[model samples]
Target: MSEPWTLHPDRALPADPATRDLAREIYAATKDLPLVSMHGHVPVEWFAQDTSFGDPAQLFVVPDHYLTRMLVSQGETLPRLGVGSTADEAVETDPREIWRRFCAGWKHFRGTPTRYWLEHELVEIFGVTQRPSAETADAIYDQVAARIAEPDFRPRALLDRFRIEVIATTDPAWATLDDHAKLAADGYGERVLPTFRPDPLLHPDRPTWREDLERLAAASGVDVSSYDGYLEALRTQRERFVAAGARATDHGHLFADTTPLDDAEARRVFDAALAGTVTAAEAQAFSGHMLFQMAAMSAEDGLVMQLHPGVLRDHASAPFAAFGPDKGYDIPVVTEFTRSLRPVLDAFGHHPRFRMIAFTVDEDVYSRELAPLAGVYPALRLGAPWWFLDAPDAMRRFREAATETAGFSNMSGFVDDTRAFCSIPARHDLARRVDAGYLARLVAEHRLDLDEALDTAVDLAYRLPLAAYERR
Candidate 1:
């Protein structure tokens, strides 16, 4: 007989008895604090429409790149996992088969954060008792499907159940934010907000740059034919996003370079990009210049600037061509921030209205570069371990590396940059546990008092994100 699944009460606490007790105490104190999800990729339409989730497979497997990426790595095809190339493409028709495949590959996720979150969802959220395996797949799927079909399992109900105080969804530069408007009409405006993500508009080398510019023009009612006009349109859109309750703007650039250029040069590059004659070097320079310009806008408008660079997005072209972007192929390249950001830091590092949160997939920069930069710059703050580095060990390492230089106040608390709505609480719970344990270690070593550690735990879990994102 297979062993029954259970989540230990002290799952991520320290092994040392005294420290474990301390960690448990700290975790218990902050475990139920309302979640402040300042940044994420959850679609706003679900909350606006208060839709019911379809099935276990759709909830657990279909939308999560973390799970699908690992499954694809183990030689399972995306189509077999119900991931279609396009919206119209036919994917795996049977959700039961998809669940079976996921169960068969379950062992592969052992020791992964994805496994931790999935197990938490299955056991704590859905009350699944059997460990996922090929033998238990059908029974578990039927159980989860039955639960999802109930009225209580709808998205809005889950949001309240999860105690999500606020969740900011990433939206395109040209997005109308109609769903957000609907939520406001329904009186959920403060709870669900839009975040302006203008990556497609910033990169001139993209094949769709001109098309994106036209869309921005239409959205902002400002002609983006010239470089100045492009800036005006971006500013207009940022104001619109602010009106829609956005507290920050998110950028996922190739690097953190923020050197500015003269208007003539910027205009030249902009015209070249529009005419489809811009070189790769010119595109890079223009992107860097635009980064500085974005900071300028943020300083003027008080929108917190979130800069997370270093990912080489769409690492594999085949998957990107077959499916659209964000199919989990983005790989991290080495990133530097200290020197690359000096130009912008020199300009607005002390600007009163500016607040910049820097995130990296490259952890080496945590202690060496990012920490020291955020330590001194009044405008700069270190975003919590992001993307590939938001796991148990990585979270601990981030605290160790960043705390000494930047200190706790300079750090942005956990953001749960996730597309999987069900995983939000699990992810935040993991963060709270990891932080509790980290703080417990500090107490055990006589670096901090128990009361201070408890306060820090609550800050990391709840207050820091709101302050960092300027959510008030």
Candidate 2:
């Protein structure tokens, strides 16, 4: 017989009875707070169209790299799991077969955050009552498919049901943002916003750099043939994003280096890159210089800057070649933020208009580097545990690591940073539980009073993200 499917009310609370009681109270105080998703990857078109999601496999499996990457690690191929190679390629056409594959590999998610989020989505969101396994897969899939077919299960309906006050979707710098404009015209602009991501145009070493530059130029109506023009084009695109209700700019670079280059040196590197004669070293230097320029732009424009560095994307070339990027090959690299960000910090760390939130896959930096920097810099706030470190234990560890130095106010509250729309509530709920448990322990230790802890819980769940992202 399959095990029963259930989510314990105190699933992530502390194990001890005294602390568990305290945690429950803390969680109850903030559990119903509206979600402020400042950073995420959900497509804006879904909200604009308000369409019903397809089958269970497409909704829960294919779009989520967190699930696909783990399944692939256990000898499952992407094509078999309904993931295509290119943008237009169709690999697995049968939803039932895809669901079967996922069910067969269900045991692999044990002790993983993906498992927790999946269970919450299945039980709480879709009202699934049966555990997922090879035997129960078809029945559960049918149940979820039936729910998805309902009008109440559509994107906008679910967003409203989830009580999401605001969500910001990651958008390419050169994107037309027509969907965003439509939503704004429809009067949902404040509810859903765009975040400008210039990763493609920042690194000239990437193969698609020239193409991305041309796209950016077209979007901005500026000629990006020279370095100055490139900067101007980027500025214009940011303004466009701001006009479309954007409040933040997202950067995902491989390193945290923020060294600035002189104008002549920057132009020289840009010219070499355009001429296809730029070396790897030159490319990295130029990228670092661009980080400084982005900070300068933020200082001028007041758009919050979000730096998510130290990820070596597409670690394996085979999967990247077979399937496009974000197939879950990104790996965390060692990062040094103290020195890497010094140049930019020196330039604009005290600027009243500039604000930056730094995210790191390198956990060592939380206490040693990030907390110290955020503690001192008025413009800097430490972003929550991101990507690989968003797990329950990792989040608790992050609090233990960073809180002593930076304190609660200096930290940006939990950011879902997910592409899975249905998983947003689950992710935020988990973060809240973890935080409540942490705060309960502090209260038990007499480090904080109960009233203060409650207030802090509310801030972490709702207020801080809005403030950090400047949503309000």
Candidate 3:
């Protein structure tokens, strides 16, 4: 056994004395609040099955894209990292060896947020004092493996231990949600909910667009060969998700472009897409049109809409082909929200019932575009910094940039959009500490009252994310 390791106070703040002291004070106030994860990609199977996790590597390394992507970047095959479609693949099987490999390469993540979260997981969750290294790999692996075998280390058990009040997992519109159904039946209803992400069904540029459309039609009991039928089918899926306790719908698009095409043009584009002949421009236009229609439907159904746009997904073709989407090859690109969102903003920006949370990979937009748009539009609110931007520096930068244009009220609070269940607490803890650091600076400068800063800290930690995603 090793001596206990603990996170240093002011772990994520600048080294400057004033900011570091303020950050420490702020962190102390909000570190224990209940976590409310508004959006994430964790499969619901773990909670549904309620099975004991197998090993340290299988539990942490295999399911984390961040870990796998880092290893792959250094010419390490993902299969050797225990990432494969099925368990039958021949690769390194010993959990200790895998941990050793990861530990050997741990220096690759030294300055990254992954290092921060992994350290938290190691010290706080696994009770390891020494940093992960080749010398400590076997002992660390054994300890984590032993801890996971405990009855209280299961997914639901960890949820309670982590103090997660609500965790929303993203699900595609075409999904049957049988896993969520099983969870609800097993009585984890209040803790886990689904967010409907309708991208695959809307992106006509995808290779299996028509096939996915067919699947949607079959699943929703509608004939989706035509544009109107497709819209109806989407509405049916939304209704199913609503019945399953979904309060929001998420859209991941290359751009925030929105178009309100007339019925004739929409039908024409749908026919072309169905025939595998829609050009890139036409497909984009069609997707934009669907976005508007979806917003109108959201107005009627009361599901909050989330637009996470301007991500250049699958940028590295070879890795994407071999490993599939979300292999950490996604890159941020400049986005023009002001022009791209004109159509949707014109149609629904003033509607009180229509709520759209805007997220971006483009940090420049937080201050210049998204904040201003969200500030003025009654329907719009700024989502937390996402993906690559979820780090402590990005969170603080987002607050500094956007709070001037769109007050804290116009921005939804932090969300741990993570798949690693154990990392949930660590991610939220980082966000809270960073947020508190931000507020503490405001206090130190006398820009905000101590009482107000404290209240805002609590809201950022708990209330805001729940209110943003949970239907009003």
Worst 10 residues of 1 by lDDT: 84-93
Regions of candidate 2 where Cα sits further than 4 Å from its true position: 1-4, 85-90
lDDT of each: 0.92, 0.92, 0.84
- Candidate 3 has a TM-score of 0.95
Q: What are the root-mean-square deviations of the candidates from the true structure over C-alphas? A: 1.6, 1.7, 2.3
Residue-level lDDT of model 1, residues 1-472, one tens digit each, is 7577899998877888999999999999999999999989999888988877888889899888899999999998788899874444558979999999999999999999999999999999999999999999999999999999999988888889999999999999999989999999988999999999999999999988889999999999998888889999999999999999999999999999999999999999999998899999999999999999999999988999999999998898877888778764999999999889999899999999999999999999999999999999999999988789988999999999989999998988988999899999999999999999999999999999999999999888988998898842
What TM-score fits each model?
0.98, 0.98, 0.95
lDDT of 3 by residue, 260-300 (tens): 78999989988998888989999888888888888999988
